[model samples]
Target: MRAGRGLLAALALVLAAPGGLAAADPAAEARAAAESLRAAGNLLSGAEEAKDRVAALTETVRAYEAGLASLRAGLRRATIRERAIARGLEARRQELGQLLGVMLGMERTPEALLLLHPSGPVGTARAGMMLGTVTPALQAEAEILRAELEEIATLRALQEAAAGALADGLAGVQTARTALSQAVAERRELPRRFAASPDALKSLLENSDTLDSFAAGLARDSGQGPAEPGYALPPLPLPVNGTLLRGYGETDAAGISRPGVVLATRPLALVTAPAPATILYRGPLLDYGNVIVLEPAPGILMVFAGLAEVYGATGEVVPAGSPVGLMGGAAPDAAAFLKAATEGGGSSQPETLYIEVREGDTPVDPAGLFELDKD
Candidate 1:
């Protein structure tokens, strides 16, 4: 019978685990909350930057179109060099015809005759000298043809180059425009999701209300400090290894910034519920994908995002180390995150785990409270 009572007590303890854990440092929690805000802010900033780039691309496309139009206009006009070459070639042909008349001993000899009988009468030194004299005129005609051909080639090359540049510029403009349009659409949608986010945040802040209210009762019973350390509380274990890609705090990405850490984790690593608590909400958020919120204390809310699955429902309590959801099945996983550390070599993995602690509805760094494994 005593053993049965002990088993019952154990079960109750398991059920009561939500209130039992979390003897952590408030400062660390604050930092975690702050980091969450920062991450959201960064994402919002990125979205704005994408919009700005779209504007720049639009301007560039306009400039490219203007340049293409100008090039087409220039191609229509004949250059002075081309006209000179045409005239020179015609004069050479006439001169050759006159020379042929002198050689053929006829009053009117065609230009073709001079070429055919370039040496006039062979087997004589005078024939060789006459061939040399006509050679210069023929060479001059060849030069004219070559010059005219070169002018046409230059114009064609410029036109081809300009066409390619315009094509590339237009493609860039279109891509940027699409991205900007997407940003605007998302910006409009996020407020509704974030509206509940503040409620969750409010719940977290209210957890501290116990500190002030229960402080009096606890002090009357047993003397206690005004603020107790949260370090002794259970640590929120990470489902996967990764670095803090974006710290908690106001960060910009899609359109608005919200509270949370953007962890660069293994692509598809499972994200589990940190502790046993009643799930307050579960659904898709604006920027956060497949989010789940849990209320551990009266006002202490834990928000989890970038999930593939939601194990528990709102008002359902979960245990510590519970598998809330697995990362990456059809969608990309937050587990596999890569940070850009170097310009050429690329980013390196961090040794420490990525976690954010929040207390009194504010963000704090999680590193201070937990004893991180160096290995």
Candidate 2:
């Protein structure tokens, strides 16, 4: 009974700190994310205004994405830890068996017989002392064995729980996504910077053959007043929660390279503006799929492409951290997520965001402009 109770404590200690038992622990992050998820869920279900609902659900979806990532990392460590403990036990099987046998013999032997050593009182005293010393050592190993088993049970339970939390989390995220879409459609509070010229936009779309030409057209037509030369940008985080998969100028299989960074993210991951920017355009463009063109400063264009959905309107000035869109691809259900999590790096993000930073029609590396360690 004591061992059973202590097992939880042992598990907690192991998972209490990030990078504690493993080189890359995520348990602590996962716990914090779980709390955030609950709060966001409550806000999503609350009777907030449509505009507020959009904001809440946007953040809620992001929280779930981050939480799911953390859960994946945590579960991997637990699986590895369980297997390591089991292997260690197996390696010591013979020694442990001998210890158990000695312990059982000691328990059953009468106290009088143990004291009446054939050698004499002094010899008997020495033998008794040796038994006393060895007994504790054997008991200690048994306790360790019991504790390890308990930890294994806890790890198994954590995996089982992964299914429930991940399922509910994914489902809740979908609900939030639906709610966000409706709320965005109903949103009318955002003030427009300028009215987009439908004719110019249509002509540009019809004539442009590549992303470069499209961006150049948008830059010339974007109604942003002027670039403030002193508009200093603070260090920025990525527009979405994702892993940086390709750097600027990374040549692909065809030996062709684009002057942009690429990020890989889970399906339906929420993307936000890295800084306050005026939306120059938002829609499908030149095979890039759903795209957003933003004028962050004079002569500076921040283009985010390959989205599943785009929010806001052309010429709308969206604030920093405002949800802009969601990444493409079908989100995995809870069971699928758990299965992939346990498989050790099996879950590869299928959705990719192509990010381009343009300065006066020329594309350049934006990696230095944002925090790279965030991944």
Candidate 3:
């Protein structure tokens, strides 16, 4: 019966041993969440070129919210794991203290002294049995102590990892918050398109059936006034330096066809005017996020979208290489996204900007206009 109890106790210890069982990795999950957010950012970059700025903004906000949610979930998991480990550690500490106390008592009252101090044969026999029982119990406890020590070490390492994950999650949330704030501020700064009255422009925008109609309306309004002198198309520069994610007419992962080129740039990349141009419009349009439309010549127009902050305004003329806006950074859950992308045989996704060129109402290839070798 005693042996059966001992076997059961050993089985229980094996089952309860720290780091002995398979468990979810909170750090890995957090990294995965980050990677997903990066993918969303890539899609948002393409969405910026969509004719509807409102839809693009909505998508962008959704991505940010999703990223935040993922980070929060990871953080919660880490917190729970940390607490569980801490509780186990505390119980182990108490067990260790008791074991140490028993060891000390045995050391002070040596077996040799016990044998020497026996009162009679009857007492000696009882003492002998006590010594036999105490010896095996001490050895068993010593083995348990060793296992507990290892378990404690494992728990400490896990706690440290959980703490690191929590810190990373908090940092990612802050970055997302800052990016969102900048986007909102830029949207608020855009001037009303129609000069006559804000209500008239709002009404026109509401009544417009399509994006092309809206574009045509703006062009007609600009043409109604005195004609601006046509300027030559100078050697244009790329707005921001980065990898070309997708070219004009290419379909993105979301299956949406892009009308312009998408550049995957570093976080907070500076977006500049490609050529000397007057800003025709600078604001959020229906699906494009924070758009900046520039008229470089009488018939040619350049559009930049997916900006977190815009520097120029409507009717403001800027020279080539002049700062127009800044690209947004990755959402807070970026770490996971980068890791997953790298592991999946792809590079990390970064802030994306969309560039589009047009001649009148027809879209033109942006590739031919920019001097790619110059920069």
* Candidate 1 residue-pair clash tally: 56
Write down the lDDT of every candidate, Cα atoms only: 0.40, 0.73, 0.58
In angstroms, what RMSD does candidate 3 have relative to the true structure? Answer: 14.9
- Candidate 1 ranges with C-alpha deviation above 4 Å: 1-232, 250-259, 329-357, 368-375
Off by over 4 Å in 3: 1-200, 224-232, 330-349, 371-375
Per-residue lDDT over 262-319 for candidate 1, one digit per residue giving the tens place of the 0 to 100 score: 5654333445555655555565544356766654444444556666545444445555
lDDT (Cα) of model 2? 0.73
lDDT for each residue of candidate 2 in 35-129, tens digit (9 for 90 to 100): 65666567666625544666676777777676677777777667778678777766766765555455445546676885678889999999878
In terms of lDDT, the poorest run of 10 residues in model 2 is 15-24
> Cα-based RMSD of the predictions, in order?
30.6, 5.6, 14.9
- Winning model by TM-score: 2
